[model samples]
Target: MGYFKDILKYEKKYRRFTVLNIVFNILYAFFNVLSVLAFIPVLNILFGAEKRVIDKPEYNNISDLGNYLEGSFNYFISQKIISEGEIKALSLICIISLSLFFFKNFFRYLASYVITFLRTGIVKDLRDNLYHKIVELPISYFSEKRKGDIIARMTSDVQEVEVSILTSIETLVREPLTVIISIGIMLFMSVKLTLFVFILLPVSGFIISSISKKLKAKSIKAQKETGTFLSFIEETLTGLRIIKGFNAENVIEKKFNNSTLSFKQLMTSVFHRQTLASPMSEFLGSATIITILWFGGTEVLNNTSTLEAGKFMGYIVLFYTVLNPIKLITTTFYNIQKGEASAERIMSVLNTKNEIKDLPNANAKEGFNDKIEFKNISFKYKKEYVLKDFSLTINKGETVALVGQSGSGKSTLANLITRFYDVNKGEVLIDGQNIKSITKKSLRGLMGIVSQDSILFNDTVENNIKLGSQNASHDAIKEASEIANAAEFIEDLPEKYLTNIGDSGNTLSGGQKQRLSIARAVLKNPPIMILDEATSALDTESEQLVQVALEKMMQNRTSLVIAHRLSTIQKANLIVVMKKGEIVEQGKHEELLAKKGEYFKLVTMQSLS
Candidate 1:
């Protein structure tokens, strides 16, 4: 129920629809009681229990109103029966009951109809907000989170909420009102029997509640297992080639099967407990009815009750009517318990504060100027610093190359400049202004990053090239593609630029994908370009072509080049050699080579390889 309080905010958002649902549900409950009570007059007509009255009943206070109405109705029916016969009287009663039943169902339909908007609207908004949060959160936030777990939150957990909570909105409103109205009618018909019924109900509620107490814990376990298996699925699809190559499919399959089996076992227990609500409530309700039947029958037989034979029969039916609603409410409570588990998971994400949000007075940087400088910055993904007290300055329009082994912090410089992760100490600056003070959108806007993986979407070549620069004309895309050496192969495809590259551009060769990535950066034409080993994964000929395009794109731009192959940085304005997160040496290509230091050793190693 506390989790329900968190979800009430969404209800407020769709308040108009929620209010309509409540209003119509109240009508439905009122008619639900009337439809059952309509049977009392029918029973009176059938049993010939009418009492004669010469005049109409007078207006009176509500205390004796029930008896007065009963007497008045019997008197009217007696006159009708005396004139019209039993068949006509029975026919009139049947028609009134039928109308009451019809209106009851009609209002029920209206309540359901109005609530559909609120239910689906909340689900839609949940998805929208989830996606926005996923996209807006910093890259570092995802490093420790499983991709499948996040996907599970968006898919399975949301579906659970829809089934358990959102769908219960109608039952939450309608069923209790139905129970309340039914009890009111029963009390008017006979208060002592209703009071006996009230005594038995709390005991039944306690039993149902006891059964549902452990449901939330089980549901949470089930949801987590679902995420675990889904992670296995995502991982299998992503690394299918490697798995098959290593003949490790059986190992992965076993892990996934075990995960699903655990999920299946947990859900079996959860659903069994959930299903108990119906029969358990039904049994308890039937027991209460039997108790009422004994007591009310004794009172009637002894003439100690105000309820007559006909009204007592109607009272029994109305009390039985109350059972179904009470049963429904019990089931709804169990469902909400299950929903509470999912609600907690969903809110954990929605309520998460982004650690990398812009400051209150953050300024939007227009474009790059002066220089990009790392002022004694220290950053760490976890405990150990990846870059420590590292400092460098790349002036505008200068191409600076950082050369190092895999873990020597070459690529980390690009990450820091782009603010993918912030420094634990010191500052990153552009034109003497701290990057933390600049709006992230504008700070990244001045840069173009092309990494070694050649990340591309499942889109056409022209569209992929136009990704960051969506409004660019076709001519601009073509000109950029030609500069990146991608236009030649793109035009050779059957559909030319319109050809759909399959997922992540898998249909293209490695070199072609790399060229498309380069074309994308070329199209953006940002002043600051970060080429993170753009040609590192290619063969001799492909690397030659991609390297040529990289040089073309880097022309007249302030560029940070992270290179493993020393040949690529031979002509850089400044080449910095790094060792264990510290700059070992930095100078022009010939100057560093002449010193026979770390840079010279790197050149010698690459030349031999």
Candidate 2:
């Protein structure tokens, strides 16, 4: 119920649709009861049980209103029987019942129709909000979570919320009103009987509720297992070549089967408990009806109660009407319990605190000048420090290369400069301003990054190049491509710039993909460029091609080049050699060779001296 209330907060925008749905449901409930009550006069007329009333009943106060209306209806029927035939009177009663039923169904449809807007609108907003949150959360958050699990919350969990929570909304609104109206009339017919009904109903409700008590816990488990299998599928698709090459298909298959089996068992329990609501409520309702027949029938037969035969039959029919809604309400309750699990999962993501965000008074930084400085910054991903007391500075138009072993924290510098992860201690300053005090968009706007992996979407080559600079004209894109040495291959492609690159740009060769990445950076034309192992994965031929483009793009740019290949950084203005988390040496390439220190050892290890 707490989760349900949270979900309803998204309904604020669709209040008009919600209001219209409620109004129509109210009318539907009213006419639904009236339709059953209309059968009373028909039963009396058919059975020759109607009492004659020669005098018309008078208008009266609220307390006498019930009897006054009954007497007035009796007088009108008597005149109809006298003026017309009994058959015509029966026809009139049937016509009234048919019309009541018509309006009941019509308004029921209207309620469903209007609620569609609210239901679908909320689902859309929930997905949109979840996606936006996912995009805004820090990269560290994803490093701690499974991509497939997050995807499950976005797709399946949200869909579960729609199925389990939202679909029950109409029943929640309509059925309760039906139950209330029908019960009110039943109480009017016989207080003693209605009170007895109240006792029996709660007992049945208690039993039904006890059965569904564990449904939510099971549903949560089931939804979680869904995420597990989805994660497996995503991993399998991503690593299918490895799986096949290793001949581990059977292992992967058995693991997936186990996940599905567990999901099956949990869902089996959830659905069995859910399906029990219908038959249990129906059986309980039948038991209550039989008991009422015994008690009410005995009183009517022995002349011990106010209920006559026809009105007593109508009372039985009215109680039956209440039973259906009570069953639906119980089912709705079960569904809400099931949906609460999914709602909790969704709310968990939407409610996640983004640790990285712009400060309220943060200023937008438009350009970089002088130097980019890391002032004694200490940072860590988890427990141990990745960068401890790390300090460095890169002046404008200088290409400073960070050369290190794999765990030497070369890439962490790029992350820090871009504000991807704020330092645990000290500050990163652009020019002289603390990077934290700059709006993140503006801070990132001043630098362009080309990482080890070519992160391109499945889109046109032109669109991929124009990603950050979306408003770049065709000539600008071509010029940037030509500058990065990508125009050669791009022009050779089937559709040239308009060509669609496959997923992650898998269709492009390694060198071509890296050049496109460089072209994308060139198009953004940022003052500071961070190229983190941008050509580390290429073949020697491809490396040379990409290296040429890298030099071309780094010309006149304040560049931070994180590299593993010592040969590539030989021409860099400054080379900083790092081991563990600290810088061991910094010098011009020739000066470092003369030092014969850690930088010299790295060059010797790479056989580049």
Candidate 3:
């Protein structure tokens, strides 16, 4: 219920629509009761049970208002019968009943019409907000979550909220009004009979509530299973090549089948409980109506009840109208219970605290000055530290290279400097100020990164290059591509710069993809660059071409290059050798090779002179 209430808070933006819906629903309910009550006159005319009234009844005190209206209507019908005959009077009554029915349905449609705007509007805003939250969340958040699970929340869970919760809103608003108005008229007709109805309703309501008590818990399990299977599907698609290559298709298929089996079982239970709402409520409503019929019918037969046969039949029809709404209300309750689970999942992501965000007084860093310094920094992904009390300094325009074996915390330095993950202990200072004191957008704007993977979208070559500098002119893009040694290949493509690269730019060779990444960085034209093993995955010939592009991009920039191959960093101004989160050697490449230490050992292992 709390989650449902939170979701309703989004409706404030569509408050006008909500007000319109309520207004029309009120009209619909009023006319709905009137239409049912209209049949009373027709029944009286058919059975000749209404007495002749020559004079119209006078309006008096509010207490006698009900009798006055009923008397006045009967007198008019009697006049019609005398002047026009019983056939014409009955025709007039039918026409009046038909008009009442028309107005009832008209207002009901209007209520549904206006609510459509509110429902679609809320769903759009919810998706937009969720997407913004996902984008703004720190990179480390995704490291602990599955891409497929997040996709499930964004897609299926949102759909569930729309289906179960938003759809039930109309029922919640309209049905209750219908039930109230019908019951009020019933109480007016016979309080003793209505009182008995009230008792029977609460007992039925208690039974229905108890049946749906565990529905929310089961719904949560079912929705979570949906995420689990969706994650399995995403994983399978992503790693399909590996699965087939390893001949582990059977293993993967078995795992996927198990996940789907669990999901099917959970959904089966959920549907069984959800589908039971309608029939169970209908049965209870019918049982209550039967009891009322016996009690009211017995009294009417003995002439003790004020309700004549015709009027009692009308009462039963009016009570039957109330029954349908009560049944829908119970179904709505079940739907909301089911929808609350998805709402909770959505709110979980929306309500997550983004730990990395700009502070109130954070300054915008416009340009780089003196040096970038890591002062006694410590960081870790989980328990063990990756960088321990590590300190380094790179002056402006210095192209420093970090060389180390795997798990030696080379890339962690790039992550920390870029503020993708904050240090556990110490500060990363740009010039003399702490990086944390700078706004993230401005901090990131000063640097361009080229990682091992060339992450390109399924767009044109020019558009991929324009990612960092979206508004760059065509000439500027061309110049950047030329600087990265990618212009020759770009011109050879079918559509030149307008050529659509397939997913992840798989249409291009590894060298071409890496150069495009460099071209993107070149377009940003930042003063600082971080190259994280950019050519490690390329072939020998591709490495030479990408290396040429890297050297071109690093010129006059303060660069921190994390390298796996010792050959790439041989020409770097200073080389730092790391081992187990500590710097073991730092010198010019030739100087370190002369020392016959860690750096020399790395170069020797690489079979370099």
Q: Across residues 435-535, which tens digit of lDDT does each residue of candidate 1 receive? A: 99999999999999999998999988888999999999999999999999999999999899999999999999999999999999999999999999988
For candidate 2, lDDT tens digit of each residue in 1-609?
999999999989999999999999999999999888866765675567776677899987998887887777778887888789788988998788889999999999999999999999999999999999999999999998888889999999999999989999999999999999998888888998899899889999999999999999999999899999999999999899999999999999999999999999999999999999999999999999999989999999999988887788889999999999998999989999999999999999899998889999999988887998999999999999999999998899999999988888999999988988989999999988999999999999998889899899999999999999989999999999998999999999999999999988989998899999999999999999999999889999999989999999988899999998888999898999898899999999999999999988888988953
Local error of candidate 1 at residue 30 (angstroms):
1.4
Question: TM-score for every candidate vs. truth?
Answer: 0.97, 0.98, 0.98
**Model 2 stretches with alpha carbons more than 4 Å out:** none
Return the lDDT, model 2, position 547: 93
lDDT of 3 at 604: 83
Which pairs clash in model 3? none
Clashes of each: 0, 0, 0
**C-alpha positional error of residue 570 in candidate 1 after TM-score superposition, expressed in Å:** 1.5
Worst 10 residues of 3 by lDDT: 42-51
> Candidate 3: which stretches are off by over 4 Å?
none
Query: For residues 1-609, what per-residue lDDT tens digits would candidate 3 score against the true structure?
Result: 999998999999999999999999999999999987877875675557776778889998998888898888888888888899888888998899899999999999999999999999999998999999999999999998888778888998889999999999999999999998888888889999899899899999999999998889988988888888888888888788999999999998898799889888878888898999999999999999899999999999999998888888888999899989999999989999999999999999999999888889999999998899999999999999999999999999998999988999999999999989989999999998999999999999999999999999999999999998989999999999999999999999999999999988989999999999999999999999999999999999999999999999999999999999888998888898988888999999889989999988888888953
Task: Report the error of model 3 at residue 83, Å.
Answer: 1.4
lDDT of 1 at 188: 82
Model 1, TM vs. native: 0.97
lDDT of 1 at 96: 80
